[model samples]
Target: MTFADLALGEPVLKALREIGYETPSAIQAATIPPLLAGRDVVGLAQTGTGKTAAFALPIIDRLDLSQKAPQALVLAPTRELALQVCEAFEKYAGHLKNVHVLPVYGGQGYGVQLSALRRGVHIVVGTPGRIIDHLEKGTLDLSELKYLVLDEADEMLKMGFAEDVETILAETPETKQVALFSATMPAAIRRMSKQYLHDPEEITVKGKTQTSANVPQRYLVVQWQQKMDALTRILEVENFDGMIVFGRTRSITEEIAEKLRARGYSAAAINGDVAQPQREKTVNQLKSGKLDILVATDVAARGLDVERISHVVNYDIPTDSESYVHRIGRTGRAGRSGDAISFVTPRERGLVKMIERATRQEMTQMSLPSVDEVNETRLSRFDDRITAALGDSERIDRFRDIVAHYVRNNDVPEVDVAAALAIVAQGDTPLLLEPDAEPEAPRERRERTDRDRGDRPDRGDRPERRAPREGLATYRIAVGKRHRVEPRQIVGALANEGGLRRDDFGAIQIMPAFSLVELPANLSRETLDRLSDTRISGQLIELRPDAGRPQRRTDGERKPYRDDRGPNRPSFRDGGDRKPRYKRGDG
Candidate 1:
């Protein structure tokens, strides 16, 4: 249906026309009406299904621009997403006067954010961590908040921010309307909806599968170290139009993009650090056939609607199942069949299985490309292009004249001259790549140490320690050894949950009861509120500024508190209340 049929305001309709959007996507058509009716919504739709505009349009139309305080708050899982949401709001509010939209996330300076908050933005789009920080600092006055949105709800859940989300929601005005959107509905998300939402309307749009029945799917189980060589071999052999390579981090995205360019493939990186204008330029280049390959992080590639994408290569398997679906969903779109190749390291096979079960699709196993096969493919392409060129009548006379002149000079044979020309055309580098050795399996009965839990550096010296910022705040999370949590899991969860990059974090120490993490001083109170709702490993993580050491229980027992009435409660010590409490000096 058309935007007019959706009953959007005149200004918003004009904005949509300016962007050349005439009709509403299925998700938008279904969600916009109910949202305008002021009903709580839980929308389930895949990426690239035009979900952003569905919420943005209604939110913008309903916005009271004259009000200075933030009336709407949208929480996203990543900085890129936060920025995208802010951009959408700006676009839809173009015709409105004095409308301000601000995006808060890690990796950006807090001084600037403080100034913006002081200036009083009308709408705030932010990641959970930063939003909570703002709430705690009282910089973000959300008492006037009328609308709250949780975009990519499942992503926040997987990133271990479910607890943080809850905390943020709790701080919001109870009268505020809430909307939650996700691509998949995992158990944790459903539990969250039950706890926070007030009888929300559920909207589910099934994703269209585009795996070609003719194009086979295969994966090579290789070590992470060997992935580069394997990918090079595949590129040499595969006849693909603009392959998309997926990486888990911005650094890896840049690294792979640079390597591909160095190897003579037209490549570019798309990530959070890349400016929006540059990202648009790079994407346009790829669509126009100027760029042959693109390496990107999942957040950077969200809502990317490019039809020329032929192959999606997962340079690194995603940490969670939902990400796998989003990554592969890049290639297969609009009734076009596509190929997705995942590089699965031995340790990551379990993750692959989780993804397979989540997507309900079985991936086929294919052998790695041999050196000979790559060479043959390359030579075949070269021969075909050259043959096509030679078939042009205008070019035949030029080639014949050159051959005649060469044969007349120095008694050179035509065969020898042709061989020389072929050698020159081959270029300097040879297309021979050696396969890497397989990774060793984890030992069956090994001692478990901090290093064994994927905490140690994968490649390099011990991580250098940095002094904590003097004015920075330290927060504690109720996750430690008891929950089988590791430093990387903590780091990944915080980075992904809080929308903080690797650099945004400070010192970290893990204790038996919880882990303490350092964050910037003068962080927003709103950010802190969001952080409290973050969950790690399906458990609510209690986040609060360093309360200067928790008070010890006078009962003198080292065991954790147990409440039998709570859901999923831990069992009490044997003998119940009759159990003796250990004294301080007792062994």
Candidate 2:
């Protein structure tokens, strides 16, 4: 049924219609009504299943926007999810006046958030640590909070925020309605839900088999610079009614779509920045053959249904399996055969296995089309044009004679003249792709001069250092939670390339924007430099020797009492409470 059929207010319905959301997703339709009725809910759904809207709509509909001071609170596992939920609230509440949604998280200063809270807000979406920090300082008031949402509760437990989550739960009013959503119901999350949510109504949305069976999936390994050329070659070799190319960001989507159009392909970009009316027109054009491709981001393409989409190309591989499934699901509709192609960089080959496991389907590795194949396809299409014209020979008699007269009069060979004409007709698009080149072997990182945008702020107070080990030395890396860098990735990059055993890797502490790992101390400068060039999460590794001294805390500043657990203590992300995960066998 349409979103209008749900228990939503006029303002929310108006916002939904303007956002181009015509229908409720499986989770949204099931979860919204219970939440609006002031009942606690536990939603079992995977990513990309409209979980944000499911909770956001009902909260906005029932929220007393006039009575500010955070009537609702949402805790997310990551800053990205926190910001995403906050944005959804703003979008859904666009028609409602004086509704303020503030997102509080680390890596951002507190003054702005404190100011916003002082000014009064309706909802606060944040990560556990930052939210706890505010609560301890008495800057955040949850006394009036009528609704409490634990988004991705499993993820929170996985991130070692269970203790903090429990603390926050204890502080909230017992009368507050609780809604907990998790992709997987682990024992911890289940127990917490039972304890926190009062007789919650449970709703489950099965994610497996979500992808269509009629679609055949394949992937090609290529470098980042060669993606455009590879896409062009694949398009030439395949037959598609309409294709949707998915990119990670709005600008990337628009760039790919514009390039395709400039190369004479019918293409348009459907992104969040594009007005809803324009997005609808673009999608309609693809359906009507006015466009052969619609480049889009994940959110922009959500809930889009069309029978004409025969191919879905992952120009950029999705970071998670849920997104990959959602992208490929655009095709294979109406029981029609469809194709899903992914472009994987050599460094990202590991993701293929992850996607396969999630979808429960093997993805065949397809070689990139050769230059010869592209030239052959171009010539075949060129010949088809001439053959089709021959069917209308009578109508083209005058033009055909004009060509013959020019061929006879020109003092050049007929073949040469025809080649020149073909060159003119081919325009700017290259008829052949560049030869494929072998990629270099992976290397370790060295100290970097330039800061990665993902780099987290240094611990204002000195960071804890590991006690001196016999052969292992500590090094700091410039990527952590912000870049989505995990501990295994650090171990995998170094241990795999440096001939070090998994046991050789030592304690890893992941901070907001950086991490500390212990490796062999006696590594030469050359090895350090080589390691610096290694890639993780598509960003080059920026590693340096970790100084053992503690950073000095400002003399006048008041700092929270930190339980200085030893460096070997398991950080939160290692199943949050489990033993050290870097010890080789834990994985």
Candidate 3:
């Protein structure tokens, strides 16, 4: 249906016309009318289906730009998504002067956010963790908040932010209008709607049921640390003309892009932080064959119409199914088949299932590439390139003269000269990859093994352990013990941001005010850029190679080593050195 039928104001209509959106998607057509009537809405639609505008346009029409005090609040699951939603608001409200939009999320400096909040804004888009922080500080005054949007609701739930969402909803005005959008309606989400929404109009638009029908979707279940290796292998083996790599965050987009470029792939990153001019330039480069790959977050790649994208790799699995649909949709367009490869960790299997069920497609399970396979792919590509270059050359006579001279001087056969040339072309360090470790046995089998220990030999009879890995690069970040950052946070950010998994990290040491994280020596430059710009605690994480800082002595006057004690132990430290000893220990 036409956007005009949604009851949008003339200004918004003009903006839509300028943007070339003449009609609304199914979800938008169904939900906008009720929402404009001030009714609560529960919208179920796939990603890239104009879900953002469905809620955004209605909210823009309802907002009174004259009174700006965060009248509307939009909650997203990630910083990247929050920024993207904010951009959509800005675009729709361009004709409405004095209307301000602010995006608040973790990893950005609180001072900057605090200043913006104090100055006042018409709408606020934020991540749950950071939104809760602002609410607690009283810096965000939601007392006048008329509209509340939970965009990508299922994603927030999957990211373990459901509790945070509930708390935020409870804090908002009870009289406020609420809208929840998701690709799937899980039991918990439905229960949340019952508790928070009042007589909400439900709208569900079925996604492309067979996600794998025209598009070949596969997943490689590997540890977080090995994702890059898996991606590299897939890129080499798959015959792709152009590709798009989706990361969870803008930092991740930049990180993966940089790493791919370092590995000799022509890649670039496109995200919100990039200016409009630069973003368009990057997209154009990809479309014109100047760049082979575009590493992007979902928001950055939205509305990106490039038919050449033959492959889409999920460097980090999306938070929910809608995001998955939007990501893979970059490829398999214009009646061309596309390939989507997902790197899934064991813990994320549930998410994989959720996506498959939502999209009505089952992703094929694929084996990790063997070192031999990776090497062969590399060699084959190299040979093909060399052969193609040789075909257009008229240097046969020159080469023959040189070969004759070599044969006469060294008493070498013509075949021997050709063999020497092949060796020279092969180059050093011929794309050798280390084999992945075998998957761990099930816990039940391990428990049974323990019970049957009487029939087995002792550990003393086992062979000596192998030497530890070397040639690893250790990097340090400004966050440490004082910031209350945990090893898991670092691991999660690296995996989600840097596109490196648990196995990718060799070692991680979190000290107060700083952390030393080690990754592979051959880590891609894109990953490094991602880590550098990534924010933890709303501060830019300054990551650099660790130059061997002095280790804290266990027996020294430094903070006492908190053992793995029980709940009795305090989680944080005060200024005092009392070092309250836990009777049980910290877990």
User: In each prediction, how many residue pairs overlap at the backbone (N, C-alpha, C within less than 3 A)?
Assistant: 30, 7, 24
Candidate 3: regions farther than 4 A off = 46-48, 158-163, 207-242, 246-265, 269-290, 296-310, 314-326, 332-587
Q: Give the alpha carbon lDDT tens digit for every residue of 151-189 in model 3.
A: 988767655466678878988899999999987899989
Question: What are the per-model C-alpha RMSD values against the true structure?
Answer: 10.0, 13.4, 11.6
lDDT for 1 in candidate 3 is: 66
lDDT of 2 by residue, 1-587 (tens): 98878757899999988877888988999999889898999999876577899998988998886786789999986665676688789989999998999988754667999999999999999977678778889999999889999998876765556767888999999899999999898998889988999999999998544677799999988878778878877888887889999987677898898889877788889765675468768877987888899898876786566778999999999867878887887887546789999999877888999989988899999987766777778778889997897799677787667678887797677678767777787777655555553233223244465576347665433343335356777677777779776665566455423434444566676666777777777776766765665455555567777653232344734444334634323223221232332432222
Whichever of 2 and 3 has more TM-score, that candidate is 2
lDDT at position 385, candidate 3: 78
What TM-score does prediction 3 earn? 0.56
lDDT of 3 at 503: 48
Q: Write the per-residue lDDT of candidate 1 for residues 1-587, one digit (tens) a residue.
A: 68999889999999888866778878999999999999889999876677888888888999887788899999997778888788778878888877889998865768988998888888899888778778888888888999999998887765666667888898889888888999888998898888888889999888523233433456778877778878987898887887899987788999998888888889999886787789989988998999889999877888776778989999987776656777777776645778889988766677766766766678876667766687678778878977987889787889889888979986988889877777787777653334443334323344678768787554335332333556555667888668766565566566654555554565566566677676665656766665576667666677876544422344765544433322121122222223232211111
Better of 1 and 2 by TM-score: 1
